[model samples]
Target chain A: MTPVSESLRAAAGTQRVPVFRARGVSKVYDMGEVKVHALKAVDLDLFQGELLVLLGASGSGKSTLLNILGGLDVPTSGTVVYRDHDLSAADERELTRYRREHVGFVFQFYNLIPSLTARENVELVTDIARAPMPATQALDLVGLADRMDHFPAQLSGGEQQRVAIARAVAKRPDVLLCDEPTGALDLETGKRVLAVLEQVNREVGTTIAIITHNAAIGALGDRVIRMSSGVIVEHVRNERRASLDEIQW
Target chain B: MRALNRKLLRDAWKHRGQMLSIAAVVSVGIMTVLTMRGAYESLSSSQAQYYRDTRFPDVWVRLERAPESLRGRIAAIPGVSAVNTRVTLVATLDVPSVDVPALGYFVSVTDDRGATLSDLHLSAGRFVSPRRRDEVVVSDKFAIANAFVPGDTLRAVINGRQRDLQIVGTAISPEYTYAVPPGAIYPDDQRFGIVWMHRDALGPAYDMAGAFNEVVLTLSPRADTARVVAQLDRLLEPYGGLGAYTRMDQPSHFILAGELNQVRSMGTMIPAVFLTVAAFLLNIVLGRMIATQRTEVAVLKAFGYSDLEVGRHYLQFALVAVLLGALIGIAMGSWLGQSMVGLYGEFFTFPTLRYEFSWILAVLAVGVSALAAAAGALGAVRRAVALPPAEAMRPEPPTSFRPGVFERLGLGRLLPVAGRLILRNVERTPCAASPRPSASAFRSRSWSSGCSCSTACNT
Candidate 1:
């Protein structure tokens, strides 16, 4: 796995040196006659194995930043350097390789194929991944081993989301991006989902960045970013990330 | 590739209605094209039979009178075989209560022999013998149509004078080529009647047989028809001649232009309609399926599948639909062609109308239908396979409806249920006609799957 580098050892829980460094990142949307600045003059850095939470309201550019970091969109003007490689300036094939070797993503709705069983859904990813564990073992890591053969329809909403987590993490990527992972679920289900995310962080030591507006979620992250009107208003560093189960609702 | 084909077949089965509609379109087209060919062939063979049975003479000579020297010269012509002179005139038959329409009777100077001319059919009784005075024979067509038989009585009008005659036998002339009945545009068997009598007997009693109206000859077996006809016409020119008609002069009523061309023209026009319709249906159905499979395409792309691979998957549908249509069309066209031949046997008198098979039609049908199916899939496949892998992998963002907008005018408070329904509807996709909508989560389907390899792989 390209994710295993000696410098990433310090990123466990907290790291000072930047593993993902950005300088003057900007993403502009040209709408026929009007241009909307989705992201502007953003500068940031992220370290390995640290859980960073992005906080913002709708249109605050939190999702935009996450999309760019996950290789889903290109920046209009910027330099995003992940280790020795420049991501923002890379071509489509290069971005694809970066995503496959270093990044994994989880979205709000789970996005599971309804016709496939939970295990098969995760296996869809692991089969193409390099240096990955078996899909069944990955699902077990997410606490969904017993429901491997159950289809998405047969499982509860929380169980399906957990399968999604297994699918993303099965490749053992260095970076995990979650865009509102628990946004669609109820509080109890959300808590269970958060516990799985926390275990993946502690065990796999993946540098996770979750984009959400839930203030309580910030309590569980090593670093917190507050965004408003396409700009980062505040960046707060926590001395310690509270254990997933220890954080109060 | 074989494994992919097998999977493709299963998916096609899952979407049977759509596939069959495409096929039906092609089958209909092939049937139309084939039917034209069949109907024309049937009519042609039928007309040919009519001509042969009538025994139409190649060269005919008619005159008010001819000298003895001229008759001998004509009979001794290089290509002449045998010759017979006859007096023919229109007459009406008088039954007990039925006065039949005008008919033609010939009074021959002598009984026709190979030494003379005897190309007529004697279906039942004997022909007029030499030196016979009162014996007469009526044609089989007249006897059969009028319920006449051997030894039946018949009356003939000789120059507006009634004369009783014996219907000694029945025979068929060798010069009547039409089943529609001689001198009638439509079929009227009751209108054309023929009888035969000795010229010596008719001339003494009726006094009109001495002046012959026509002279017929049976040509030598090896004679050139056109050359003989020209020589005979020149020899008989002083006797008053009009024209000569050979078997080749006749054109089949069904094939006035060209039998093959007629068949082809009909074959082309009809099936084109159904095939076009089938193509349109395929395009629409496939387009809808691709649109619905948008997310799945992204997932597959994320799994390292090239856009070309994904596009080929969609193209399989077009091939399946079109080939199926072609197969069905071939079967239908063949069956209809045979059935049409049988239908024609009722009025036609051919030995048989042979069934001709054309594989070209089958090829054309399949080719056209496949083209249609492939054309239909273009938009869907293009749209699904065009996106960048990353774009495909991400779920579409939810379209948010502002709660304040719904709350305005106190509508949200009054129609809370409706508002909730609208919100839920917006969240769910507009999935309607797609048969295999995303078909479940991304699972790598492989060839030769079994328990040995599947246990660790199912997840």
Candidate 2:
């Protein structure tokens, strides 16, 4: 039998640091003749319960950096430390383990399974998590309690996005990575979706990162990181993040 | 894994119409194959029964010369019932309605065994008239083909001479129709037509004055055929122009043997065609299912489900689809098979065309369906198992994008404003969720074929 000594040591090491940290991470993809640099020496961190907005132009690498921080990608050269476990150097199995235990991801498309109802969709994620909130409770937090039985097709576009957020947050994840969570919604629906994310952050204390091309969406975050040409050109901090309802779309 | 299984079940349910069509196809093919085999067997047995009941001559030898004194010697031999020599000739009849070719055989039998050999009831039919002045008995099959009925006036041409005769009645002959060989594969013998007339009918026409042409033999009770044939061959040798044969050397056996081979060949070939199609279809269906679940596969991987676990989930759908299809197919196949056999019974005389349940066939249908469904589902399982959690979680692989080189060639922009823009994007990319797929097409075709083949194996 393998001893648990190292695993015990690693657990203690992970508890001492912030939930996630990235230093000079870069991801360069080889597309035949073009060596596309998707991420360029990006340094980032996510503290507990903080909603960080990642704003950038198209092809500016906001999604790539977010993917790396969520343990969904590996940095080509730099290190990504999730607590003490090195996310970048981890093998496939270890990376899978990291995803299951620590992170929940929401894509721009909402990605709610078309066949499943709102509650069932959230239940699918929660069923696999280490510790998870009830699917009903998660939907209720998103203000979709009454529409839990409706399928994605039956729900409005904004309603579907809320269900996706519920599914992501229901896992009680250490980090929730939203890659343009409201990208497909109109202004009114987009506000409703933002409010759900804000509620999850405030009530469940899950660290969240929202990636988008809209600069105006940044006003609702604790820290705003802007990228251009695959590089982070600006970082701004707000004294107090504006309430999602108070911020104009 | 369990959650994946639930999802897979949902997919099958969503596509139930397609599954049903496939099942219907499989059932039809299986039934056709079963019915064909059944009809062939039935024809063989019925022919055997007709011959046995009537004591039909096991072998009849025909020759040009008449053995002048062979009758007594041949009759004395063991297993020989009676020996009679009669002239046989083919002639045309100048009928009241139509002049047509008719075959006639002259017999000088000591007694009548025509009814015995036919396995029939004497229905308004007299045996050969003692006077033998143009009197004849016709078989049912011969009557139908020639448009003859009871009391119909018929003319027999003997030695190119027309002789008018009264149709005495219709009789059945076991040897007349569907002469089945032992171990026959197909039903219904082709040599199913014959007409019989008495020996006295030819006496005055040829002026032969009591000579004979050939002798037919029926073995004594419990006599061995080979031994009887040897005895008769020796006894008839002195007569100088006679040939003797046992049942094994009969021409009907040869003809029936060939027909049996044809049936066997058909039986072996038809089923294999449907089985191969089923396998190909199953492969396609499985490929599609795996391709569609891009994110779910990654999520399952992240949950630490092993490759086998994921594979098991996908494979479950295949199992359900195949089993359900196969059971429905087998039921429909059997029903259709019986009807097909019934149709054969009309054309071919059968003892009792029974629907026999063959466990081998049932097992074969089930096994084939299962294998096809499993094969189709296999790609998904393998993809899930080999998938790295990180790759699984990442967004799906980008669609195949074709660069607008032609657009850059400058004609695309000048062609039309809106058409060029739409064409440019369409030419460049094909995605999974999009109705027009670059990704899903490859996967869906495999799965659809698999699904369709397994479900429609009969078709």
Candidate 3:
């Protein structure tokens, strides 16, 4: 076993279960006369209710790993098991059902529909979820209770990102996959958005994997994995998690 | 409403300018279909009712001379129901108000008007009196054209003799619904007229005191019209019979049928052209919308919306526009159809012409428009559904720019940056640049050509 998987297994032994187990995971994108190897035979395990941060540069394939875990994509050659379900073997419809039931996603640019208000955007998840929190409650959890009626265009960047967070958590998903969720905000706003995600991870007891390129933000996670050129270069377990206020850009 | 539906409504409103323009095109197409079809139905029903009320003849035969006793013999033929023999002659008239000499068709009418096959609907005054040989009933259109009231007198040369006839009545007939003179294609009300006289007076004026020159007959509902026509022709052959014909060959009915056929063809063909253009516009607009909303679609799919759900959401956008256009078209078409029927009443002498709104046609118009819009939106909807959420979440790659035809020819360097950018965009979106403008140009050209053709036909 690789050192990262051994550390993950060792971490899971005492306190938690491994929610996602991936083996020999690799992804290749064929762009007509060029084939880009996004991931190279990577192995990973994410523990239940633990916050994990994937730190990488722009082309380091952190987003691809998160997408594969969230059932948004299938690796070129890998086996991914989310609890007991074989995600790599799943078809499109099965993947949709899996995502619907277990996964929530927050995107970098805050992909909240501009036409809908903050509450309505949250309701987009609650409407289709099997067991969901009320949309208003979700917004209140994200610290946007008073701005629930404002459209995305009317809100500031930080507020829109909060609404996106509320939308992702409204469904009460088992895992939240965030791809550069604070990438578009200023340093202070990014810290606030990260604080909301931290709060949600602690309160809801949901497994959260946040992908970012900022090294300082890695101190806020229970575990941090750094990747370079489609390969994991280091895996570290933080002895003490720092609160959002103490973390700086 | 669900959040997705709210988003749909807001999106539609945000693009209201494009949606309303598309709706306008759809409304015009539907309006044409309803107006022409509604007018056709009104004219046909009115003509049928008028013909039924007048007991219009099924067959008419004109001969040099046939004895009055031949009426019974013609009536005894199998399938023949009722026969009336009458004397008809042409007379030259000298109208008091007009400088040009007019032609009059003089037909004999019995004292009991119901005794004949084709009876007139008297619009003013009484029918010709059996006791007054000088009294005549003039055609209503001719009377109105010349300002000839009931008490006016008309001088005519009958059998080379000038005679003064008192106009006792003005009437319209089912047989003369489209009253054009013989050998004329258009109705000239001032130059041609119909004069109805008592049979006793007209028979002697035409040098036929006891015989008649024309025979009109009705037939049984189940009768074979061709067989009866042949029998009548055989019986009148010894009396110098001109070949007999059914009402389908009658000049007035034939002309009216031809006109109705033209209306029907125009109704279908013109709407097809308009709808084709609307569909093309819809394809362009919806395709661009999907292109812009790529990230939104990916987010929805990432939230676990199925491909079908996303596709249905976009399709509802098209349906909303179609519904709005259909409602507007129905209202406008109904009103225009009524006005068209009223206009027809002035030329074709229908006692009553009412525009009948057909619910089936309205439903069909909406259905057809929906189909067209759906067809137009299919490619866009498919593109939205087929997009992989993972790929769509990322920003689209920049379009690969290369030297275009003008640049390769060395002329692009002469233009400014803005012009070069425009040329580049046009080159990148060749379909967007070419088809729409060319289609609209072709539409306008064909429209003008059609207008000029109709104007020429009218003159």
- TM-score of the A chain in model 1: 0.91
Candidate 2, residue A62: CA error in Å?
Answer: 2.0
Top candidate (TM-score)? 3
Q: Can you write out model 1's per-residue Cα lDDT over A82-106, one digit (the tens) per residue?
A: 8887888887677767777778888
> Deviation in angstroms for A64 in model 1?
2.6
Fraction of native contacts under 8 Å reproduced by each candidate: 0.10, 0.22, 0.76
Question: What is the descending TM-score order?
Answer: 3, 2, 1
Worst 10 residues of 3 chain A by lDDT: A8-17
Q: What TM-score does candidate 3 reach?
A: 0.88
Q: Which scores higher on DockQ, 1 or 3?
A: 3
The residue pairs that clash in candidate 1, if any, are A113-B440, A113-B441, A115-B440, A116-B440, A119-B459, B29-B271, B33-B267, B283-B376
Ranking by DockQ: 3, 2, 1
Off by over 4 Å in 2: A1-15, A21-24, A43-51, A79-102, A126-134, A186-188, A213-226, A232-242, B1-177, B180-328, B346-352, B369-459
Residue runs of model 3 more than 4 Å from their true location after superposition: A1-4, A14-16, A83-85, B76-82, B111-116, B127-135, B151-153, B163-168, B218-231, B400-459
For residue B35, model 2's alpha carbon misses the true position, in angstroms, by: 4.5
lDDT by residue for model 2 (B320-421), tens: 666676677677667765676566545444334455656676676567656755665565556556765556556555444443877777777576755544
Clashing pairs in 3: none
* Model 3 CA lDDT for position A176: 96
Best by lDDT: 3
Tens digits of per-residue lDDT, candidate 3, B228-307, equal 99999999999999999888888778877887888788778877887777776677677767777989999988999989
Query: Which 10 residues in a row give candidate 2 chain B its minimum summed lDDT?
Result: B450-459
